[model samples]
Structures are given as structure tokens and as C-alpha cells.
Target: MTAPLHPGRFAGKVLVVTGAAQGIGRAVALQAAQEGGAVLLVDRADFLAEVVAEAGASAAGFQADLETYDGAEAAMRFAGERFGGVDILINNVGGAIRMRPFSAFEPEQIDAEIRRSLLPTLYGCHAVLPHLFARGGGTIVNVSSNATRGINRVPYSAAKGGINAITQSLAMELAERNIRVVATAPGGTEAPPRRVPRNAAGETEAEKCWMADVVRQVKQSSFMKRYGTIAEQVAPILFLASDDASYITGSVLPVAGGDLG
Candidate 1:
């Protein structure tokens, strides 16, 4: 039930959003479609098909593991074949896969954090560039987290930091081509209950404590001292993706209730 307030903001545009099956990704895709954009919703989950159906004729779905280059390639190919070109790319495929103190993390866990929260944005951007270049210009809105500043999830923080760096560097490099690259660093957000959870079952009490600490830090760090609603997070994302942000590039806007991270 996320209706479009800025109708026609994305009219006639073709948008590609990764991680489109749920949460912020799903919200963005639906809002974009409602605003008159043709959306290509991509996710590895089969449930992505349901989101596509919900979008009706304005959107289509593709299944792909966006952490890999092959998955990124396949998604871009599908978009090109179906939509002819991409006008906006929303790299919303990352999340903190685990939350723990930096010292408590295994090396493999560190690697997984980077893979889960960073590589998709890197790979998705790389795969979609050629398509955007072909179209002569486009916009990219990367979803980063305000936890980059306050967290028990150290590895995830680093991954989102990487997102900030890439957003800055890519925006400069692509400016001449009119390809604006920007990011939104969201703090805590409230959404529908997850059909899938990030934490595994049978977590130890110690692990539970660690997760609780993360939640505490997120709220404390926000000036509002509360999590934001899904619509609050979606508004700035859509703004950056829309032509309204044509003059804005290489910037990471924080949508964290005054948490300036």
C-alpha cells in the first residue's frame, strides 16, 4: 500500500533495483513503478516473482545472486532484453549479515560481511555501467547504512564505508557523462516482519547480547532516539533517483533522524 506521492517523477524511465523482494528494495521498486517507471526487480529469491506480479505491468522480476559478477550480468541482460535500456540503477542488495564485536569475528565471517554488504554494490554498478553509458546518461542510488559510524558490526561498517568511497569516486569519474552517483546512509528503519531473518536459529546468549548491543547503538546514535519508518527512508532514495537530484552527485545523504553518519 505504498502509493506514489510524486506521480510522474520517473515517468517513461526504466529502473533496475537489486534486492527487490523485500524491505527498502521492495518499497523502492513499487514506488518507482507507481510513479510511472518501468521497474526491473532483481533478487535471488523466488518470491521476487510475487513482487513483480504485485507491480502489475509496470515491473518485471529477475532472480540473481548479485554478490557475483555473473549474477549482475544476467540481471543487466534481462533488463536490456525486456526494457531496452536502464535509466536508473538502485543498488539496494546489501545488508549486515551478522552482528558481533570486531574481535569476536572469524576471518571467514569478515569475508562474508564484505561479500554480503559491499560486493553487490560494486558488481552491480560495474555491470550496469555499459547499459547506462549506452543510454547516454543515468543515475545510481546506493543504499548504505548510518551504522558506518556507530556499530558492533565492524565488518559491515567497513563495507558501507566502501560504499561511500565508491559513490564519491564514481560520481566524479562519470560526471561528464551525466551519470550521477549518490548514496543514502539510513539509520534504523521500521518495516514489516521479515519472512526471513538475518540471524540463525540457536544463537548463543552471548550472540544475542551482541545483537542487542547493535540495536541499542543504532537508537542511541540517532538524534531522534528512534527508528525511522520505511516511507521515511524511501523518500530520500527516490529523490536522489529522480531528476530532482540532477545537481546532486558524489554525496551520501544520511536519512538517520539527524544521525549525521
Candidate 2:
């Protein structure tokens, strides 16, 4: 869907991507870089640096635990120091911290889920707003899930619902500044086995088993036989981050392969 039309759409721009160690984050960073944008990859003290190095001069990485104040600050500093400034911020750092029947989560578990899956995106946006405003304006792409449409994924649904709201509110708030804000709701995605390691933090065995099961569940939920690949999902993101999407904002462009349709 996001073909190379102009080829130089993002030339000279600087984009910061969180959760850049792997999966959707990694793919988005590479896609942006290939389109000519400088990339600042960020993650918790690990995956970031490796991806950045692979990006060469077109990219660099920031290692931090974004759930904390100091961690977010350090990442902001890293982006500024590496790229001179940030013109685009992709809030791609979030996941199903804990999945269960929406009615089953303990209050504490819900809180943790919100902090881990939703707050980091907010913090990243806050960290980059100054740079974006100073430069007149920029674009932001927040990756969410089809669960945001109130599907049955419980905690993930709630977290993504919040992301959807934030994307809308921020889009309007930044519209006058010429900063575009949008979110993607992906479902039935193939996601492809990532080139970047899973989570890159060496998730505990229990976590690994749970995540692996999720992949199975997602496939089973779909009517179609296969899941959408990362590249297909990445298409809308590329458009949202490029000049071609300048006239679009506050749109929850779904990449869910007809799952929510």
C-alpha cells in the first residue's frame, strides 16, 4: 500500500522510534530510513543500540527504560545529541503487558499494563514536543491494535483504546502547529518472525510461552487463513509519516486486514 512514489519524501527529516529493538518498531525504523529519514531508535538499555548501528549514519539508538522519568529524559537527550533534533516521533513502544479476560485483571495488573503500554507513548511524545514545535511542526505515528476498536483482547484493548484517544486529542492540539498526529490499528497481521530478537530483553520463560500463545490465538481469531505481514502493516505508517499524508491527521487508519471491517 505504501509504495515509493516520490522516493525522497522524508529526505533530511529526523524520526525517533521507540521499541526499536525489534518487530514493528524495527521494521518501521528501517522503512523510514530507506525513505531518507534519519532514525533515532530507542528501547530499554538493550535493543536500541544494535538497530541504530545497523542503520549506519542514517540512524542511531537510545537505550533507556521509558517507564521512568530519568529513562525518558536520557532518551530525549540521546535523540537530540545524535540527530541534532527530532522532526518526527513514532510512539511504537507498547504491547500486551498482560492479557486476560477483561474482567480478570487485578487492579494492580491493570495499572502496570497502563503504565507500560500507554504511558511510554505519552512520555515519548512529551519529550519530543519541544523539538517539534521549535522546528515549526512534525508528524507522529502511534502504533495501536485493532483491539482499540473495542474487540475482545481485554487489557490490550483498553491500552489501545487509550492510544486511540490520545492520537485524536493530540492531532487536534497540534493541528495548528502543522504537526500531524495519527495512529494505526493493526489486526490479523502476519507480523513475520522478527529479524530483531523477541523483546530483546530475554523475556522469562513464562512470558515467552504467553507471547507465543498470543500468536496462535491471533491467527485463530481471523476468518482468513493467514496473518498480515509487517510490511503490509508498515504501509499505512509510511504514509502517515510522509508528506503525502500531510492532509491527513487524527485518523485511526486501520491495518487490520479487514478484521474490524
Candidate 3:
């Protein structure tokens, strides 16, 4: 569904969102456009043009890997050269590329996960802040996870915990610059889990039922006893990215459906 239109909140602003090709990233990017900002959408997804079409021309799509400085550099250049400068930087990239049993995690696996899940939050902030600060102020909203509350996903949880730290630290560092920094942590919701084709090729009904049971267990962790909506969670995110949240910073807003309680 499209966001409610608000022309003045982000009018004439240049915004950028990393990991914007799907899921929460797509929701955030599209909402940013609806609110009157021109958005630079970044991700490794090849079909970003479709994403732009979905979000519209106020949106420009770019494919930039988050693994290396070269990838990050290309993204920074795209924003400066094409959009002039960014006024809102949304750090919406981060995820578990692969899952592993907690007991079997290798140091290399943990390091790689950190680089993927935490580094983009770091690089996007560092890369985009100069443009924002140069304009004398801007907004940053980092997407984190409710996994940080407990019931860890091994390295993914550890990495997200680190992201929360970055969100807090950056908020403090940028406060004097008139920039607002905050984060949104979402709990397990109706959003489908990433599909693993090879593993599910011949799953049995009993096996699937067991998996469903596990998901219910995860959902019950929420105080509201339900999952959140893509649109519902995205509202708080857009708020933190808007002038409405002008006085908010260094805070981690939960879209976890009351899960932390």
C-alpha cells in the first residue's frame, strides 16, 4: 500500500536508502518518495530499476555492494554527482546471508557476518553524513532487529547488537551538528522468512509443522501477541527520518509489536 501524502515534511530533500530493493528497505524508500523526497535507492539487487518504477522517478536506483570501500565509494559518488547532496540517509541494509548452528560458528563466519550486517550501517553513516552535515543538518534512521532483546540468532544477533551501539554512538557524535540519529528494531512479523530452496525441496508435512511451531514460539515473544505489518513498522521509521522527529535522537524505536516487554 502507498503511504499517506505529506508534501511539506520532506519537500525538496534528497534522501538515500541502502538495501532498498526489497522488504523493509523497499517500504522505507517508497514512503520516502511519497513524502516528497528524491531518493537514491541502493542495493546489490540487479532489478533496482523495477524498484524505482515501483517507487517512482523521485527515486533513482543504484546497485552498490556493501562489502568493499569501492562499492561504498560508488554509492557516495552517485548521490553527490546526481542528486547534489543527501538530506536523509537511511541505513536499511543488514541481514544474515547464511544461518548456522550456534555451536558450530567459526571466527571467519562471525567476521563475515559482522562485515555484512554491521559495516554498511557504519559506511552508510560515515559516507552520507558529510553531505548532510555540510548542509548543516539531516536525519539518519538505522534498521536494527528485535533479536537484540534476547533469543539470539547467533552471529546475526551479535552483529545487530553492534549496530545498536553504532546508532547510539553516532547519534551522540552528530548531536552538536544538528543531525538527528535513531534506530528502529523490528520483531518477527508476517514478513516471510528468507526462502532456502535447496533445503525445502522435499520437506515433509511433519517437518513443516515443526517449523511452523517454532515460528509461533517466536511470535509469542511479542507483548501484543501478534506480528507487525510492513506498513505499520515503516511508519515509525519514516517518522524518525522526518521533521516530525526533529527532536528525537539516540533512541531505538521498537516496531516489535510490544516484544521487548
TM-score of each: 0.97, 0.84, 0.88
Model 3: per-residue Cα lDDT over 1-261, one tens digit each: 444656666789998888888778888888888778899999887777788998887889889887676787689779878888888888888766444445655687678777888888888888876688778998888988877644324677887888788889988998999998899998765654533232333545654564465457567887778777778777888888888888899998878877762
Write model 2 residue lDDT over 113-232, tens digit each, in one string: 777778888777777788888888999899888765443346667777888888999999989998999988887555546554423456566555666666666666556645787777
Residues 1-261 of candidate 1: C-alpha lDDT, one tens digit per residue: 343479898998999999999999999999998899999999988688889999879899999999899999999989999999999999998887777778889898899889989999999899999999999999999999888887668889999999999999999999999899999999898889766665545467888898899788888888899999888988999999999999999999999989987
> Which sequence of candidate numbers ranks them by lDDT, best first?
1, 3, 2
Q: What's the count of clashing pairs in each model shown?
A: 0, 4, 0
Which has the greatest TM-score? 1
Model 2: colliding residue pairs: 187-256, 189-228, 190-227, 190-228
Candidate 1 regions exceeding 4 Å error are: 1-4, 200-202
Deviation in Å, model 1, residue 173 alpha carbon: 0.2
List per-prediction Cα lDDT, in the order shown: 0.90, 0.76, 0.78
Clashes of 3: 0
